[model samples]
Target: MKKLVISLALCATNSLFAQQNWLGNTSPTYEELIAHLQQLDRSHKEVKLYNMGPSDYGQPIYLCVVNGHRDSSETFEKARQSTTILINNAIHPGEPDGINACLIWLDQWIRAGKPLKSHDGGDLPVIAFIPAYNVGGMYNRSSTSRANQNGPEEYGFRGSTKNLDLNRDFTKMDAVNTYTFVKIFQALDPDIFIDNHVSNGADYPYTLTYISSMKERLAPSMQALTYAHCIPTIKDYCQIGNFELFPYVELKGETPEEGIVAFNDLPRYAMGYASLFHSLSFTVETHMLKPFPERVKATLQFMNATIAYAIGNAERIEIARKEAIQWSQAQTYFRFNYQMNEQVKDSIRFKGYKAVYPIHPITGLAQLEYDRKQPYEKYIPYYHFYISQDSIAVPKYYIVGGQETKVIASLKANGVEFQTLDSFETKTVTCQFVKSYKAPTRPYEGHFKLSEIEIASSEQAILLKPGDILIPAQQERAYFIHAVLQAKAEDSYFTWNFFDSYLQQKEYFSAYVFKAQIEDLLSKNPELKKSYEEKKALDIKFAQSEWDQLFYIYQRSPYFEQTFMRLPVYELND
Candidate 1:
């Protein structure tokens, strides 16, 4: 037993040395993270490692599930029966404080015999965390990624191995990491989720702040507990620990004092994704301007406070989540496309440094600046409410063709309850035909996203083959189903270029052949000719370009592929 302890200590020592050399300031590398988890597994009976799917860089993601038992089944059974808190670390590898902080927290937790218990003497909330979410990003290390961050000496880059921001890829499921993450997320179904990050936009006096899941979007059952109990309790805990807390200091026009608004956490972001599950989630944003050590310490404090709160209210949280699941299953209309409600006023006593402008030597222009020496406090009107501007009625079911392998793979990764059609069958389906869509002028996160979406739908009989997928809308993940399936939803697969094939015209007619075809096409149909003439009259470009006229005529004729504008997924009527 003593030899085992000695061996584990030596392994930990070697791993710590490797981490310090690789990261330069205590942030763990991918190798060190694996090593640390191994050591924890050996040293404590409470630790269990769950392997997720491979990342884009071909490394497996791991979730550490900690409880009072050595058996994995027992631990997971307890998690299912009680409450669970999931902490995700090092998503943006450049912001690695959470990685180191969680490591330290674990060491302390083990030393203290893992005495986490619920207030009523029931089982404590099970703690689960991804040691390092973006393995590729962590290994792709550098010294210059985050220019404003202090004293990391060297840190990992923000982009994953594919050079995509994983944060923005959550709802899109572009990267393999995001795909694996969805699997892990649905499997655990944590009551509380904390995604650790570092803030780069605005400099403030507070070392630790967080962006909560939009209260309006959170289910009513969980909303009151989050706003009234959990947040306030954690805020108090931070204050008592000598680290002040505040809402994430979002700014506009260069400074926070100019009136801060709530973070528009579209489904692409972690918090927004968690909100879909009605899980109380937060994005812990440590100040980037602070020293790395200070930032890590503050993050540890914040995490500790969060765990304490979760433990205290485990039963209540569990009940809230159950209620939320039932509420979602019964929901027919789900809201999307949220906008901030500036009219509904609320305030936060912001602790910040005074802002000033100074001339830049290179540009000879005034630059915005903040003076940390001149600290000030004021009641700033904070608009944190998000009004859901648009909504979509829930569909009965979604059918995907066999050709959409990528979409099928994403559905599988997200644990979307689906079944493959056993044989070819024809059925009446409500289908959307794309009219027109516009991609961004420039690439974002390695793909040109279509933002301007327009579609037309009709009920028609469609064939479903053996490999096609059938996804029902009635499930625990109903809201997520709505978000991913809705074409115009901000982060839908359509917006992420999943259905790019539909945007292209696979069949076309030659100009010479179409000239004769157009005369016949227009002469037979007076209404079509009248519409073409009106279009030509209304737009000079249409009138001047003879080629455009012929192409339009051909498009209206049988030359265009009928399936060209059709989305892969079809809706089945109940």
Candidate 2:
């Protein structure tokens, strides 16, 4: 180990010294970045670059591992067993601070003799990074994409080749990049996960801001480890590096003076997806107003601090993750639909510039801007509490219909364990029916994303056909399963349009033809007859319209389609 470290140090100093290309107001192109990493992989055995999978742009997404075992399989195995930190860069390719920061970290580590131990003599964690996640965006580079960003000569666009925001593709898995990302993420199974980006909000004095996984969404062990241990430790380390760490500036109202709220890290985002499986997830946001070099430096400092934290607390992290997995398996209910509790507020000492609205000379409109000359430091209301509006009783197993191939593929990609039924069978299970939902008028991330979802559940005897998948809730990925399968969860597959076909009424009855059947349907069922009479008596519109009366009775009749609004996923409680 000593010899290898010394050799790496010599290689770093002599042949592969730290390059200045990433140190200024410039970022590397996709080809240049890959070629550099490939060179490093060839030069040092500790550095390993793997072509995980292809992106939407037809280019392969790469995972670069530092301090790995010599062989590919063994390196991944070591990462899974030991403490690991996985940094994902350039998800939004325009925010390339992480890419430069990671490069600088590699250079500095190699030059520092590649120490294998922390300051307290604990083993250093495995460090892995996805050099550039959005390959298409990285290739389509320009300077004008980020109009408000400071001093990057050129950068990639925010959208992928498919014109989808890759950040929002995590739960939906619409882009090939998401699949590759899942492959990389599951392979590493890192204890700490970071997605790097630049901020797009109010001007804050702090250059570095981080968004941790929402506390309500995390398992108890993970929640404590993240908020009580990891964050505080990283903040101290950042302070030591001559920088301050703050929460992401997600404004409560319009500006910082009104206060900031904790970011709701829904499963659609990269960090939130990682948190589902108990990774200590964070999104690093460098102030976009800061110079490119300054942002890069701050990002690098954060990386160092996080790595230092992982090194010092490797055992604790591993234990917390293990406990989290167990906690997930033991969960009786899965809570979601988290809304920020505006009424509950804590105070944080914030340093920010005064918000000023001035008339724009070009447009003759009042523009909101931060006054650099009027910086202030004071306590501000920080609304960090989030309350889960709903929760579902977790089932023993979830049986997904055979036709839901896309959802099955997504679950498989995330390493969810399940058994495929070989033959048909019948079992009583709890199924969710879509009561109501609102879809966006316009497309979001290539989907008419669903919202305001209300669901109703009932016990039903469902026939399990051949090729149907039964996923046990007593597995390591239970949290992930619940996050996607629960129809009303904010980022569930249903919300992402995975089960849109089921939402549509596949079959409809002609009002004239069904009118004859409605009389017999109500006559045979006394309860239905009473309800129909009550509806006609109470509602003037129902009494007046023949089609409405006939259709309403027809929908409740036995001839109506059973699977019209029923979800393909069924839960087995017993």
Candidate 3:
């Protein structure tokens, strides 16, 4: 009888393990999530799980590979030839719908034993999944952070371990998560990239919506297919799956009906980063007002639609992407710092519930109130067109000073093709001298990014020392190179405070010592004295302040470092 009881207990334990306890119709803790992913990999030959890399807080990030043709190692190269899709979940860990949704999709797909078909008719398109991108943030679980979001009993925080928003750190790459992400991205070289998220603005009827990489900014070969085919097909698929989908709603003053503007995604954003590589990218946003399970279902439907569309249109997308790459190689210049072209506009049929301003009982101030009973649809102006107001000529190579280690590391991280100079030599090179640039008074994405910059270019003889990097602009990473090196770019390293040390004077002269130097400077040079006296006579402040006068004289002197204000990148011609 005791032996019989032992056998029964063992059977019961096995049955309990088989149950879907990991996915409890809601968010799962990081440990439980990993356990489920491992289980899927073990059970299915087509699915594999990999630890991407260590997160900021010593947690290992994981990625799931689902290929239809064969085992993971056996078919990666074959999978690459076909359309590859990369889906990232839980970037903001508080938005945990994607985590649960991805788990459900993998479970069902694996159970069905169906593999994705390829456009090449040989191997299948691979699904590269980053289960939870912000691992540190995902493990830092909390229930109160997402106060407005409806039903996930508990979830993670918005910020990473170091309190950095990983979304904004794509370009700056301050977090370890981003660095590891680069490894995964380069390895997959995906044809399509999707980042899952939850919306936090005005409530709308649509359960699922997406922000595509701006159409105007997309490669010429891809512009037509994106709007005319991919978008519409995905919309139809999602609708068929019983999920209402729409273009991402950008609200103005808590009212979406006021009209929406196309979100300008800079390199700092995931979509923008993917756009630089000519990849079709999107950001999936589910309605935060809905229940967690509903949001998860909506996200699942969106992912399914995305995969279906990618698989069906694989050949066309591949052709367009290759054409785009070919066109990019022939390009000689890159534009930056785009602004909305108000003169040009398109219309999107928008659907939303009515919202009104009402006095809040707590704060006694006007607040937005949405009435679900009243619903309407209308064509609204979408300022989707953008014109690049500034442009930089693509140089054959960019020479970076050996001392700029930070710049070198970033260039390498972005996959910029570069080589080190063998020997120290003085060469006449064209370079930009930073005249003036404005930094925002308030911090944006943990940075007071530079903007509205002015530069003066001149041909000067500079030393190209050994170990200095020579970055070539004739490769795939040309767009990224131009964007980051150009001072005018809003998302450049210069704007992100990477080269801030150069902005300040490392060496200075005392006012007492400068007075004597100024007197000698004025006496020796007639042109200098004339210019200085005229300036002093014209401006009362210059004449009255002895410190200002001395500083002005000091600036005109050779003692001031000429290279101090100049950008490190030196342009080389073909």
Q: Against the true structure, whose lDDT is highest?
A: 2
TM-score for predicted model 1 compared with the true structure: 0.90
Model 2, range 1-574, lDDT digits (tens) per residue? 9998997676656434445777889999999899888878888678888998899999999999998754484348888888899999999999999999999888777668878887678787889999999999999998998988996899998999999999988999999999999988988888999999999978878888999999988999999999999999999988898899999999889998898899999888999999998999999999898999999999999988888888888889889999999999998999988998888899999998998999999999999999999999999999999999999889899999989999999999999999999998999999899999999899988899899998889998988999999999889999889999999888898998888998888788887688767767888999989999999999999999998898888788887788989999998977
The CA-based lDDT of model 3 is what?
Answer: 0.80
Q: Model 1: per-residue lDDT, tens digit, 1-574?
A: 9998998778668655544443336576788778768777776678877777789999889888888353353235666556788899989999999888877777766666677654566555778889999989999988888989985776788889999999988877778898778877777777889999999877778888899888777778878888888889998988899878888888745677778888877788988898888889999999889888888888889888888887677778878888988888788887877888878868878888888888999999998888889889998778888898887777888888888888777777666799899999999998888888887789998889887688788887887889998898888888788888888788888888888877777777788877877878788989889999999999999899989988777777766677878888798867
Q: What are the lDDT scores of the predictions, listed in order?
A: 0.82, 0.90, 0.80
lDDT (10s digit) by residue, model 3, range 76-135? 574567688889988899998888887778766655555555445543568888999898
Per-model root-mean-square deviation over C-alphas: 3.3, 2.9, 3.7
Model 2 lDDT at residue 219: 91
Give the Å error, residue 549, model 2: 1.5
Worst 10 contiguous positions by lDDT, candidate 3? 14-23
lDDT of 2: 0.90
Full candidate order by lDDT, most accurate first: 2, 1, 3
Quote the positional error of residue 417 for candidate 2 in Å: 0.7
Using TM-score, rank the candidates from best to worst.
2, 3, 1
List the candidate 1 regions with Cα displacement exceeding 4 Å. 1-25, 68-75, 116-122, 360-363, 511-553, 558-560
